[model samples]
Target: MAAPKEIPLDEIQWHDPFEIQRIGGLHSNTVLFYFASSPFFDGTSNNAIVYNQAVHNENMNHLIHTREAFEGRLREMTGLEFMVAQEPAESGPGMGTGVWVIHKQTRRKREPKDEIIVHAAYYLVGDHIYMAPSFSDIVNHTMITITEKLSKCFAIADKARTWSPSTGHGYNTASATTSAKAHALESKGTTPMPNTQESSTSEAKKPTRSAVDSRLAEHSFMIHMQYGGEYMDENPITGKPGEFHLSSTGRKDKMPTLALPSLNTTMVSSSLTQPDKKDAKAGEKTPKTPTGMSKIKRKKSKAGATPTSA
Candidate 1:
């Protein structure tokens, strides 16, 4: 093998991963590629075809779409299970991703540039099922970083010989879900928990938190209110009745206390001792009745009722 040529950074043709649909290149053994880097396009063609991962591929504005379309044709010609990358590396956010694209005709007002269309014939070499992406642009080229990655990929591909299942392409452990979570944590590179038994025990026993579903106290209360719970005490304008302290956000709930300000005492015998008057007031027509007291409140009309007001 000849020495790998160094790719210049500025000469890379950039593409956006978000523009393609499920876009990612596949090994000859038919495994979809995860993006460790981006694609590149210089003025001339080379062994390196740059691309990205299988995320953020709804937009197809560049040559990446063209590459994607070519890969689709490759899949059709090869019968390989493959798609385009949806996104590039984690760094690709906000930053652009390179992709190849296809457009039928420019608007009639603007004269269109020279368009390339691909037609194909299928031939099977070995165990490889060569199919293609059903589009025009074959490969979306991006930057030199991806070009270098592509060169590495080609070298690896060449050393292993054919795009066969034995190459261990499917067994990529670098960016799997659990490993990805671990890798993401590793990249931030914080210190591990203290090695004391209590700390280690606590860390080991801790449950994975629901980051998306977790809510602030107020947010939880608001959600509770949305479902018909009233938070009258939470209003800043109308403070809660008496001694309750506000939350950090200045919200409050009702506070309970035994002592009444007006009475200055608690009712001890209210239910047990005052059954008669309370039952009477409550309109319970009981088994027993008093001779003078009736169920109705008969206003003693100016008759025998003594007036003793000062």
Candidate 2:
């Protein structure tokens, strides 16, 4: 590629469509061709069609013409010397073709050490020219996106929150209420009332206890009725004041008594006279016999003096 020719600010002529086309030649892919063909393009003024065509094309002559027209328009309208410079591509793909439109602080001779302040930058890649976004624009867009996402999150959290006077804050109240209702319905469907016949049958099937005296009274009444002694005044054997007794014929049919073993009198006396081991351990003392005549001697003396005593 040929080196870019620097056009002096004083030498740049006023933008003229016919002159630019006559010098640079027109092509289908050129911004100038589109501008010439567009009905809205006036010979002296920049219009939307011409500007958009410049942005969409990548021709080198188109870039020069666009810069010239911009500078002329700014000089005519704002009286500012806004210069445009084509910079060499940097070290990466699609970085080769870039144009930096700059605004200078002073109109003196251009110095190599002077700081160049960029007003805007345009990048050419493949068949199009794109304006680079400023830092402020990127920051503003990121802040807006974060704000929108936070708002959505807050809305969802608010909807999930549940509040009650008794339970305080919780989540998913609707599901809890649904589960309670389901449990109530299930209990209602499963439980039934007890029937009268069923209750009566159950009571009849259960066993009950009776007093011993009441059972004996019932048996005595049955015995009296079977022996034809229902109106008897007293029991003949025990002399008890009762009408329940067996007749003579029923007494003959009674069962024999069971034999009981007899207890030994000597064994009973020996057991009663013996001192218990528990009483001996408790420190109990046995009473001693009085110092006097024996009972036998006393009885003999009483017998011998029976008549002498007056």
Candidate 3:
């Protein structure tokens, strides 16, 4: 595959790779939009993007210290001092609304020859307060072109969606008119209601065994073992096997009495009662031939005399 060539700044539509993401909030919703080819793109980088975050709240601090916030972040990253200058100007719809223009310049600690300048605009459109900040090495005309495109893209949508006349922070009658129109359309059943009950039921029907098994045992089953002559079922909860014991009624036996075979005891008792084999053999008397005579000759003489004596 071939690499994608960079687009020239003037010829660029300034809208490629523009993406938006919803930033969650407890009290208000915020939408952030990024223009990929903005002056903020430092060339030869991935995810080199810049943002304009639109906060949907009336009392938001949109104009205050926006320059300082950008400088503080740059100072933290580069460890250098930044000089800031602010200018007030009219914005939106033939310069009817007011806005703050912030300009900041700084140099990195290691790069003595290099300088960075950031330009940010803070303005409100309808119910949303927008903070559009960008930093780059581009000329002022390019910066203005990029900011204008971004402002126009979000301003129209913000006026249509989040702005309401009931908010009482009206920037223009068009915002109020759009708010009323959206409310009337909604009341006329243009939007569908959420199926909250069905969603909750489905969520509840999800198996809770995985949660229980994580805390308890992953695999639950019966464990049976034979101890002595009685079969014992192990308790899965306490993981302890049962022993032979009486029932709570005291009359009935819960388990049979455990008994060992008597072969060992019988062998021990018989050994204690029987006579010693060595002592019995020593007590037995045995007839012996004279040391000088042969046993064979004595046996022959006895057999020959036995016939005459009989």
lDDT, candidates in the order shown: 0.39, 0.49, 0.41
Deviation from native of the Cα of residue 229 in model 1, angstroms: 8.1
Model 3 alpha-carbon drift over 4 Å, by segment: 1-5, 16-18, 21-40, 43-70, 76-93, 96-106, 109-310
Question: What lDDT does candidate 1 reach at residue 194?
Answer: 53
lDDT of 1 by residue, 176-286 (tens): 657777765663338665567988699778753332233344477687779765555443443577855554555568799788544212233333344565547666654
| True-vs-predicted CA distance for residue 37, candidate 3, Å | 7.9
TM-score for each prediction?
0.13, 0.27, 0.20
Candidate number that wins on lDDT, 2 or 3: 2
Cα-based RMSD of candidate 1: 32.1
lDDT-superior candidate, 1 or 2: 2
Best by lDDT: 2
Candidate 3 least-lDDT 10 residues:
24-33
